[model samples]
Target: MNKNSKNLLRFAGIFGLIGAILGAHMAGSGSYAFRAVHAHILVVGWLTLFGWAVFYKIFQTTETVLTKLHVWSAIIGSIGLTVGMWLYMVKPFNLPEGVTLFIYIGGGVALLLSFLLFFLLTLFIKEKK
Candidate 1:
């Protein structure tokens, strides 16, 4: 519908893809622990973030700093996740474990910043009710 809505859908799709991958692995009675990182990347990485973006769009959620924070954080975070996942999937390119973890930090940082902003903004922003 709009740029933000489109973004939400895009992110949500990515999340679904991750879930599907994890689901496939689990279908064979795989361990959840093994998929723990995938679960976070999907849930927090895609689902939660996308859902929040959608919610913000529908509600016209407003927070000057926080709003921007949400956008940039999610954007950067998703990008980081993509890089990390890519490295994980295609290791032939040659990468170090530290670098891989750093890439994941991008997503983690974004998620953290977004949530932190949400918390701060909710306090000052008037509730609809």
Candidate 2:
């Protein structure tokens, strides 16, 4: 497996564990406060990352600058978005509103960019003779 695939899979596993724990915590506490955060963690962090990892493992694409960008962006975006969501919604640390908003928006933009790059990557897949 490619290094990117391995890294993504690792990230996905971590996210999956986090999401599960959060879900369990919510259930036990009877509080749905972390609902959106948990959902995003599972979807964006676990499922999406896992899917991307699988893609990289199955398809032998030439690694380019775009590939690096996409990999890093996906990882960073996932962390930023999930953490930003928690900070924004929960405000556990009572952080400034502006900071939380910026993180949330920035993370979302990065994730969007990752998606776009992934689409372009698909278009340039090396055909197996």
Candidate 3:
């Protein structure tokens, strides 16, 4: 597997574990407050990262600046979005609403860029004749 693939896979595993733990916590405590967080963690963090990892593994993509940008943005965005969501929704640490909202929106924008880069990447894939 490529280095990027390995890195993304590890991140995906971490996200998956966190999501499962959150899910279990909600189930045990019988509170659905973490529903949105848990769902995004699984879908955006785990599933999306896992899919990107598989793409890197299967496609012979060169590690260019674009690739690096996409990888880092995905990781940062996933963490940022989830943590921001928690801070914004749960209001832990008594953080300012503006700060939390900025983090959430910034993370979402980064994640959106990652998706756009990935689409451009697919267009550049070479035929394996």
Candidate 4:
């Protein structure tokens, strides 16, 4: 597998880990709010972004630096938000509520940039010669 494919697989595994933990917690707590956010971060933020990166590589598509930055930023940011969710929603932490919100929102913005790049990349492609 290429670098991008590997990234996708890695992120998938991360998501799986998060999901397993979420499921285990849900069985006891019966509160799914955390589960829902975790699911979105992993499945949507990580998995979806990774999938796009891999697809782009498999198709031998070119990307600019900004696109690459977006991909990495999104992946890293998602991980951050995933942790935030665990700390704040899943289990209370020492972090203040405001700090938690900032982390989550920042991560979300990073994810938004990733998707924007995905959409922009899709629009500009080399016409098959």
Candidate 5:
């Protein structure tokens, strides 16, 4: 498979893993304390990346530097936001609240920047005809 296909499948796998964890947590705890984190993981980590992967594949975009940056930024943002929110909500790691909040927001910013980059790249592409 090509890189774009790999990226999509990888994100899809992430989605499955996150879904399993969320399911187990809900089953065990019967609480929605981590619901927001779970949602973000599915949305940004899985759906957004998957969408981008599909876009790249369909548009025949090469594995350029911008794509690399987008992949890295998305991975970092997705993991950071998910972990940060988990820490903020679960307190399992005993991190300071402020630190966790910072991570969450920082991840959000990175994700937004990635999206903007993707948009700019899209604008530059020509239809494959």
Candidate 6:
């Protein structure tokens, strides 16, 4: 009903889409070569973001710069991680191996930073008297 809820639902839809693709891939290929990527998409993209959104909604936290940063970081981190891992798994983009590794590492760091920001936000939550 609120912005946080909307964001969570939107990301839930994203997870659903990724899950569908994963299911189809498994059905057709019978190989989980991209399993890590799929997992990241679900966990980081769907679960983490949804969890934070729920937290924000329930706590009635006002929108802050950190919240916006969290949203963007989560989005970018998820996409970067997913795409980077996919490229790492399969050279679909024809990028150099080192470049793919860099992307994967960078994505991981970005995701970590987002989590840290979330933690910071939690610490700053106003307590109900």
User: Candidate 6 clashing pairs?
Assistant: none
Weakest lDDT window of 10 consecutive positions for candidate 2: 120-129
Cα TM-score of candidate 6:
0.85
lDDT of 3 by residue, 1-129 (tens): 689999999999999999999999999999999999999999999999999999998888898999999999999999989988988998879899999999988888889899999998999876333
The candidates, ranked best first by lDDT, are: 2, 3, 5, 6, 4, 1
Q: Which is superior by TM-score, 1 or 3?
A: 3
Across residues 2-117, which tens digit of lDDT does each residue of candidate 2 receive? 99999999999999999999999999999999999999999999999999999898888777898999999999999989999999999999999999989988898899899999
Instruction: State every prediction's TM-score relative to the real structure.
Output: 0.66, 0.96, 0.96, 0.75, 0.85, 0.85
Off by over 4 Å in 2: 127-129
**Residue 80 in model 6: shift from native, Å?**
0.8
Better of 2 and 5 by TM-score: 2
Task: Assess candidate 1 and give its TM-score to the true structure.
Answer: 0.66
TM-score, cand. 2 vs. native: 0.96
Candidate 5 residue lDDT tens string, 1-129: 558658766975787688678968887999887788778777877788788777776676677888788777877777787787788888988888899999888888888888888887887776555
**RMSD to native for every prediction?**
3.8, 1.2, 1.2, 3.0, 1.9, 2.2
* Best prediction by lDDT: 2
Clashing residue pairs in candidate 2, if any? none
Expressed as tens digits, the lDDT of each residue in 14-57 for candidate 1 is: 77787778677777775554365566667765777677666665
Q: Alpha-carbon error at 110 in model 6, in Å? A: 1.3
lDDT of 4 by residue, 1-129 (tens): 546556756776777676777778878898776766767766775568567656655555554685577568667777666666666675576788778877777777777777787677667655333
**Residue pairs in steric clash, candidate 4?**
none
lDDT at position 25, candidate 4 = 80
Output the worst ten-in-a-row residue range by lDDT, candidate 3.
Answer: 120-129
For model 5, where is the 10-residue window of minimal lDDT? 1-10
